[model samples]
Target: MMILVFERVIVSLDLENGLYQEFSHPLYDYEPANRITLGVLRDCLCTFSSSEKFSDVWIMKEYGNVESWTKLLCVPQMGGCGCYIYTKPLYISEDDQVLTYFFKMGKFSLAVYDSIHDTLKIPAIQNNIHDLVPEAYLPEIYFESLISHFSQD
Candidate 1:
């Protein structure tokens, strides 16, 4: 059985070159059960589930590398790379407990590092991402929160 399940959320960058992609989820570690065994689907993207969410949902969009600085129309991005819309589902414990071990920002892009798999998942906005892999800043990520959102079926 597949342990991990994912959902896709989106962020749009208002830019010249508009493009987008859908983020992919891992094969394991996102199921409802007791004592989930951590498994690696790729060299990156890990966890008991990709179920960490703490943001306002929005439409997904893309932007260009260079922005109109003189006109002050576009805001500068961190990586300047286009990103994919992702919906990540989390694991609600049998005891009605929600565990969120990811990142979140007010309006800025959210990025995280999977220590178990050793990779960084950065949501790009420019259009230079060759492939999604764990990044060098993977060690800076931490567990966000653990709340209550479970069911006993």
Candidate 2:
């Protein structure tokens, strides 16, 4: 089982050997609200975050080795405005280099990060994304349940 010590830091337990190893960023002093997303892209372990001055995408070149961790990309927040926000990885391009992601502070539009070119492109009007808001499939309203489903008379 995998246990996430902090929001960004991941720790794994070896059941057979009863050994524990750090699988993510060593530093633990970060805001609890700050979120880091982990995924497997291009067959490599990757994590993305926008909690710092710049958005950083970290990739573990050789798994289980902290030294092998590398910052794949460090994107300046809001083009260097310094407003930190979360950026979630959506998918990897067919070439396995370009990464498509979504910025938590953006206008609900998809942004493509070309790691090879070290560039970011957001297709707003071209992609027909305007005033897009993330929400659940079903609209929800807070209310009290009048009956219990588990009670047997």
Candidate with the greatest lDDT versus the true structure: 2
Q: Tens-digit lDDT track for model 1 on 14-80? A: 2345755333322322332332223211122233322222111111121211121011011112222
Clashes of 1: 24
Clashes of each: 24, 0
Cα shift from native, residue 4, model 1 (Å): 17
* TM-score, predicted candidate 2 vs. hidden true structure: 0.53
lDDT of model 2 at position 9: 56
Q: Candidate 2: where is the Cα deviation over 4 Å?
A: 1-8, 13-21, 26-33, 79-84, 92-98, 103-107, 115-119, 124-133, 137-153
Q: Across residues 77-151, which tens digit of lDDT does each residue of candidate 2 receive?
A: 555422235456655666534434444454344566666676666655542534544432211223333223454
Highest TM-score scorer: 2
Q: Give the lDDT of residue 78 in candidate 2.
A: 54
**Global lDDT for candidate 1?**
0.28
